[model samples]
Target chain A: MSGHNVVAEAFAQTQYQVGGHGKRIVQVLKDVLNEVEGTVEGDMYGSGKLIADFEAKMAEYLGKESAVFFPSGTMAQQIALRIWCDELGLKKVAYHPLSHLEIHEEAGLRELHGIESVLLGEKDRLIQLEEILNLQEEIACLLLELPQREIGGQLPSFEDLQKISAHCREKGIRLHLDGARLFEILPYYQKTAQEVCALFDSVYVSFYKGIGGIAGAILAGSAEFTKQSKVWKRRHGGDLISLYPYILTADAYFDQRIPKMGQYYEQAQELAGLYNQCPRVTTWPEVPVSNMFHVHVELPKAELEPILAAVYAETGVGLTPYVREYDESTSSFEVGIGDRYAQVPKDALHTAFRLLHEKLQNL
Target chain B: MSGHNVVAEAFAQTQYQVGGHGKRIVQVLKDVLNEVEGTVEGDMYGSGKLIADFEAKMAEYLGKESAVFFPSGTMAQQIALRIWCDELGLKKVAYHPLSHLEIHEEAGLRELHGIESVLLGEKDRLIQLEEILNLQEEIACLLLELPQREIGGQLPSFEDLQKISAHCREKGIRLHLDGARLFEILPYYQKTAQEVCALFDSVYVSFYKGIGGIAGAILAGSAEFTKQSKVWKRRHGGDLISLYPYILTADAYFDQRIPKMGQYYEQAQELAGLYNQCPRVTTWPEVPVSNMFHVHVELPKAELEPILAAVYAETGVGLTPYVREYDESTSSFEVGIGDRYAQVPKDALHTAFRLLHEKLQNL
Candidate 1:
């Protein structure tokens, strides 16, 4: 299966698509209105009690003794790395090249936190233990994103992960997990959330991305660390009042969707198996270690647009968030298995791929 | 007027008593649910845009060219001062000691932007042109808060304001208006909102403080300045999506209450006149230049609490947000006027003050 075909298949199964259109405005309105009237005073100055409760609950759920919520994952990660640097008396964090904290946090770590990043792994490779071992010193923390979102949701092996965690502990380097997609990765790794979190000194999770909550991120750590983090949270203007709505939504989703992550993992396995039989598409990591997989399309960039449009028009689903040049102008696309993709039959993916292949072959 | 009398009079005018005796939870819930929504998208990202049109309209109403919305007046002023600093290559902003930006922005200008502030005028006096002239070097900007919330809602005379504006212009220092309570000040100033805004390069206003929207602020400026501000807005994570609810509420209040500020102003003057005649109570600035006025009551801390509690219990209205020890040993109280306070007749306040005086004298 080529990347083009992979994307075509994914587009044939968008969950958000309702009869080939957006969710109804009335539903959106109802949800939004509820948000406007929060459980307590949601203003910045007032609602201190609500914020305290939300933070406390977030801490308990994340398996940390304490936590503080931030407005964004960018701020949470940047602040975590900064804390690690200050604590370890070092200036650099070792991470993979595709880390979200590095690429998408808008240079905030460099500009705001004044910490440097050492990109340790090869551009296409995950941050291996070898890279961690090569650094003798000058590293404050080792950041690992389980099921890295950017390079297709691939996770390091459990044994490899244990080694990295142990190495960091031995070296007195903190292990910080950018667990934005940790919920999606849990079932694939056959681990409970608490078990995985035990490996890291601090973990940052986003409520908005996979949890379906409104915007917020929680940085969970030791009680001492989180207590100190309150000062920093206030300084950054992330100390919001009345976070009950976000917390309630996260709680509701935590029970319903978290248990279904295993299902997504199973569905992703089936989707990957369908692609494995095809020659044109090469799957990254051979198999997705999580609910998402990236397909390297062996097609020209010029053919991507029309094919994608045709797939959406014919199948009434748009799968990919973005398609771009991966190497030497060759196009690549990433796909993630969610509720919508699970609804589409595996045969539709096969059919979608065949149609995409026919279209690309003509080009 | 004695603080005890004020408290007693406050109780005598009660529509209902305190301890959940005044307002029913059902009524509170109904009003809140009907007026506000349950889940506001935390749309801090482009939430400003929903109010962008309203802000532009406000700018026009205030006789300005443009406006940008902020979650806080502190943020708005700090960002404005930062822009002035960046634009003029200056390191310091001049403001009064009690300026909210200097005291309340939590030292963000110094900690985050590395900019310094020079407090002008007497320690607690309205900013004067004489203080501006005494500044040793070029400064980035000058901040003036009309009816300064911290200092008993005081404002300078129009002639004095014009003089200060001219002085700043001659010195090439940008002038900014911290108009969080500007609406309340306008009727007392007997001038249009435009007249006040015209004296400054930037003006900031609030929604919840006086206009009584749930929570939001606006920063009005020139189009070019606001364009640069949009970039800053995203940098600060202030861009929110779908701010229609806050916008709609702000719009409703702007139309309904803005014109009524004059009435509040008239009531404030009457109350000030009544308080000035009292021996134990001191009214600052002689008369309030706005709907908000602060009364300094020379009462013992222990004596003040019960009377205030009684007032709130009997009247179902707040006489003060709190009782603070200006000096831990010396007892002092501050009174702020709100819609509730305005509804209480001057004689009620006089009677409350008489009761307070009698109680204090007996003590």
Candidate 2:
């Protein structure tokens, strides 16, 4: 009950997922491969026209002078920070404490690249402008993760972001955006991907997250920056003999999902309202700025799991199998609305939520 | 005539290749995916049954206690070296001057890992035992590449290799094998893959090279070493969400081609003999020790290219599209014999060689 097997079993028994299911993912990859004609070149190394074309398309979409594809977002972000720090001859970078680089990447920036991080801002909140102003040490770069994922997709206002960007410019510190969910947040800002990206010196986007590619990320910036990144990419062993599968999937997903961000965001808001109505349930943000928000319930994961399982058995609709424990009696889970959620009629979604609330009350 | 375009054009028109064609590679990937039933789980990170199974198979084949998959040989080897150097607290690694880390990786070992290299031997030759004895500094690891790829697939005698291995053991230095072409060289050593690997503390092999996988490398060693490598691999951004494609292709190729390496080596010897009989041509070692050898033609690449093109046009037999320039007049190209080469009739191959010699003599 406490290992990966439990999670795997829960996921297997679930009838629905916010993201596309395994069969759909495989079909997408197969379809993309079929659509692209001619022999897939580049052997085992990630080169050839396919990779070049995908990078070019991403650069054009992000309104950057150039772009490079990386096998993972962790690598893309680390390399971007490394390039900025090395160029300025400084090793100190500033970012929110909840940043992926700070918390998830095992401090590779410090251990591998010899770059120190100056953590700013409070936990579970958007980094305020004063956090930047309060920094006394000379930092080479500042990384901003839009709609901070670890904190329930919270985002700063457009005005606050612009002020932060202006402050970094005044201080001559490079700004890098960990825009892993940039597309998901764009609708709230009423901005184009390029408009949001232009505020930073470099931007990284994950194709596999909201865009639903199997795996890949694109780092876009000025031509010089991207050119240097390629060398670092090679050094980091990020350069594969071929990235055709990831590239084709990313391309297909961009076309299918990016334009519909607004609808997904609206669905998230509607979903949040349903959770809010249940006296035992509350949302972290009370509303969603993007297509994702965290839902907190009074019951712990152990008690909540079986109730959800019972609900699924009775209604044929699957809620989350487990919740992330927040306290002795409270737990939370992220609700990520995508094309799959959008396909379900609103009334069915309402019935599912009601059944979950009723089951929780009985438990 | 001198750039990649010419090479691409020639390859496009040629009916034969040292490796399987693009369609065949794609089909193999598809076939493997189809054969594996059920959802290939692991989410967007490589931590599932497929990756574990592949690693286990590789470990068993290499006679190692454990093995791990890396996205690139460059990353796998660098991580292996880093672990060894850190354990010994010595930053210096010994390798041949023409080693891939020394010449091809843009000094990433020094720049990224802070590991210095003690160049061990002359170019196009194996590292001698005397070279190891002469080193003054405390060395962390000694890297040996089987069939020394950069020098047209050259290998030392078994006795010499044993001497070097014993010396490293005596010095208490870690021995690492850059066994990228391990399978191809096995026939010459008359050793099982595990037998050759047993001499080294750690060994790396490329799936894309002899095994004909799309892209991946395997690093094998003791379970403790491999466990440490997983952390390093994650830090290097090598843990993909799914490595199903690479694993499946590797599994398929290992079964199909590994048993046929002896035949490939014999064919390489036959091909080298034919080239040696031509007055304008010479094989680098006069004979191949593996399934590949360097072909040095007396004409410059520019002079030889058009003649090869003419032969391809008239005889439907494809000579190499271009040769790597060795000097002002002489040029060299690697002739790698694989299953694809095994498909070509001996008479057709001889015809291609005869026509190439006649055209080159005229030029």
Instruction: For candidate 2, write residues A312-354 as lDDT tens digits.
Output: 5655555554567878898788877777775656666677778
Off by over 4 Å in 1: A1-29, A32-47, A88-91, A240-256, A271-279, A282-286, A325-328, A333-339, A342-354, B1-66, B237-256, B270-279, B312-318, B328-354, B357-363
lDDT by residue for model 1 over A1-363, one digit each (tens)? 445554445544553331111221223334434544333444244235555677777777778888876656765777788778888788798888888766655555675456788887776877777878788657898889987777777788888888888888988989999998888888777887788888899999876555555455788999777766655555444443223334444555555567767777777777666555554567775777777787776766555656766766665556464566776546777666655665566566666666766666666
- Which stretches of candidate 2 lie above 4 Å from their native place? A4-11, A18-28, A42-46, A343-348, B4-12, B15-28, B31-38, B42-44, B360-363
Given the true complex, what DockQ would model 1 score?
A: 0.22
Clashing residue pairs, candidate 2? A44-A241, A45-A240, A45-A241, A45-A242, A46-A240, A46-A241, A46-A242, B44-B241, B45-B241
TM-scores for every candidate against the unseen true structure: 0.83, 0.94
Candidate whose TM-score is highest: 2
TM-score of chain A of each: 0.85, 0.93
| CAPRI accuracy category, model 2 | medium
What DockQ does predicted model 2 obtain?
0.50
Question: What fraction of the native alpha-carbon contacts across the interface, defined at 8 angstroms, is recovered by model 2?
Answer: 0.40
lDDT, candidate 2, residue A194? 88
